[model samples]
Target: MKYDPIDSQLFIKNRKNFAKYMQPSSLAIFNSNDIYPTGADSTLPFAQHRDIFYLSGVDQEESVLVIFPDCPKEKHREVLFLKETNEHIAVWEGEKLTKEKAFETSGIKTVYWLKDMEKVLFELMTQCDTVYLNTNEHYRASVETETREARFAKKLKDKYPAHSVAKSNPILQRLRSVKDPIELEIMQQACDITEKAFRRILQFTKPGVWEYNLEAEFMHEFLNNRSKGFAYTPIIASGNNANVLHYIENNQQCKAGDLILIDAGAEYANYSSDMSRTIPVSGKFTDRQKEVYNAVNRVKNEATKMLIPGAYWEQYHVEVGKLMTSELLGLGLLDKADVQNENPDWPAYKKYFMHGTSHHIGLDTHDYGLLHEPMQANQVFTVEPGIYIPDEGFGIRLEDDVVIQESGEPFNLMRNIPIETEEIEEIMN
Candidate 1:
């Protein structure tokens, strides 16, 4: 991990909150994610499961965390199972977490090697009547590969068929949705790194630069700042490519007078910062491009204000759609007659601004949150609104990560990153 060690108090508080919601006589378990294999003797980078990282701050594979507040033995109530390390293993794969180090990292005193998991779990299973299991239930999740958590959950259920099973996803969804103060600080750092990368790109962008060249520039800035590169795949969409919402083929040459929409961010200590900014390849936006850019910026600003407490996720998007509708009408993309004849399900504004305006952002780019529930304070979200015009051969999008506060407007994390047309132009020139 390139990032500094986090205060374990954050994990301690998170575990306490998780325990408060567990059923009496129930034990909850969280497992680390698998180091997925890419080919023979090679693997993709290890990414810790967010649940275990959230609860224990154990950012390693082949690890397990058990929380049993009702246990008769206090030491056994919270235990960590980590892969055993030895002199030979240390030489080959580096030092795995020692029992002592695990305690320091997780704040849990009782730690065991992975080999002893079954022996320890058997005793706990007999004492607890119910077991809480973690599962992926994020609204946008479409997982097909069976995760380590799912495999362990199947093993637990097979062995302990009589124990009552409960889902931990709902509890986690609500808990992880609201950010703690420490979490906010880390997320802010991620956004700060993203801002640094964005500023670097503003000066580097110009006509004849390859899209991939810009991508390399972002990665260089991110790694130099101690980040593990982009939180998600970067979209360095130039010209008509911006019309494709998920464009990532950053291979074309940026022509003069064309616009490039960069949807990229940096990941710090497993936290994600999402940002999208459109800029002119020629270092100055044309009259028509500036108009659309300003309109998108205006809509982004207005949508951010609606992210306060008690706001409904579905209704919030509807309100944002109205704002976009008005902007599109003013842009001449939609007429008054188009609004009147538009379908209720697919509004007239869909022609230009098709995607949702905001979504919860955190550890995962699309973080966990129940859309049906009302928004709450401390919840971080991305306010992104874009206008795609294939006929005009350019698109515009502006986005910022913001935190919803108790009162007043939400706080913008990207406030320092340049957004104003004059500001961007000034910096570029």
Candidate 2:
């Protein structure tokens, strides 16, 4: 891992929290993500499953974690199964985690090789009446690929037909939503790295530069700061391209007086930080551009303040819609008639600002947080508001990652990143 070693206490605490939600005499299992194949003799990079990594801090493939708080045997309460490493395998694939290292990485003292998983699991199934299986239940998830966790879950159910099965997603959704102090610290590091990349692009962007050049600049800064590139597929949209919500072609040349909307972030230790900023290509925004940019910035600031505890996700977006409506009205994008005759399903402001104002940002860009539940302190979110004017040939978006506090306003993780029109202009010049 390029990132520094995280204290195992975070994983220990996470496991304790997760175990507390499990039924008595029940065991929960989590599996690492598959190292997917690209084709024959080639494979995509290995990315650890966020759930297992959250609880074990084991950033490797072919690993499994089992949590059984009420186990009769103390050591079996929390066990780790890792792929055993041999001298020949070490020489060919570099060193894998040793038993001692696994213990250090995760707080679990009992470690066994993957070869013994079936035998040990059989013993464990006999002791527990219920089993918890991890699943992808995030609101934005559209997974079609069969993950390692999914495969394990199928086999486990087939082998233990008598055991009552439960979903781990509900417990994890709530637990992972609220950030621990250690997790907040790591997320802050990710935001700081993203800030560096944004600042770099502020100086590197110029008229006639291709959109991909800025993308490369951001990647260079992320690598230098020990981050694993972007948290999500980056959007380096320039001019009318910015109107496309998920534009990532980054092939167009940035003309002078045009705006580039960059929605990118850095990932540190598998924690994600999401940020979005729209800047001018020529180091200065036109008068009309400044007007739209400031309006979006104002909406973002107000929307962030609404992320306090007790705010419901659906209601929060409704409120943000009102804020955006006012801003769009002021910007002359929506007139009185447009507001009054708008469809209730899609308001007049949707003509300009279409997407949701905020989403939970953490391990994944759209992290796990039950939308039906009220917001809580320490939950990090991204407040991104934008106005896309295709007729004007540009778009404006301003976003920041914020932590909902116990009291007062939410804390901005991207506070160091330049957002104000004057500051961005000054930096670019």
TM-score per candidate, chains pooled:
0.99, 0.99
Off by more than 4 A, model 1? none
Task: Summarize candidate 1's per-residue lDDT along 99-144 as a digit string, tens digits.
Answer: 8888888899999998999999999999999999999988788999
The TM-score, computed over Cα atoms with residue i paired to residue i, of candidate 2 is 0.99
Report each candidate's C-alpha RMSD, comma-separated, in the order given.
0.7, 0.8
lDDT of 2 by residue, 195-311 (tens): 999999999999999999999999999999999898888999999999999998889999998899999999999999998999999999899999998988888888888899999
True-structure Cα RMSD, model 1: 0.7
Model 2, total clashes: 0
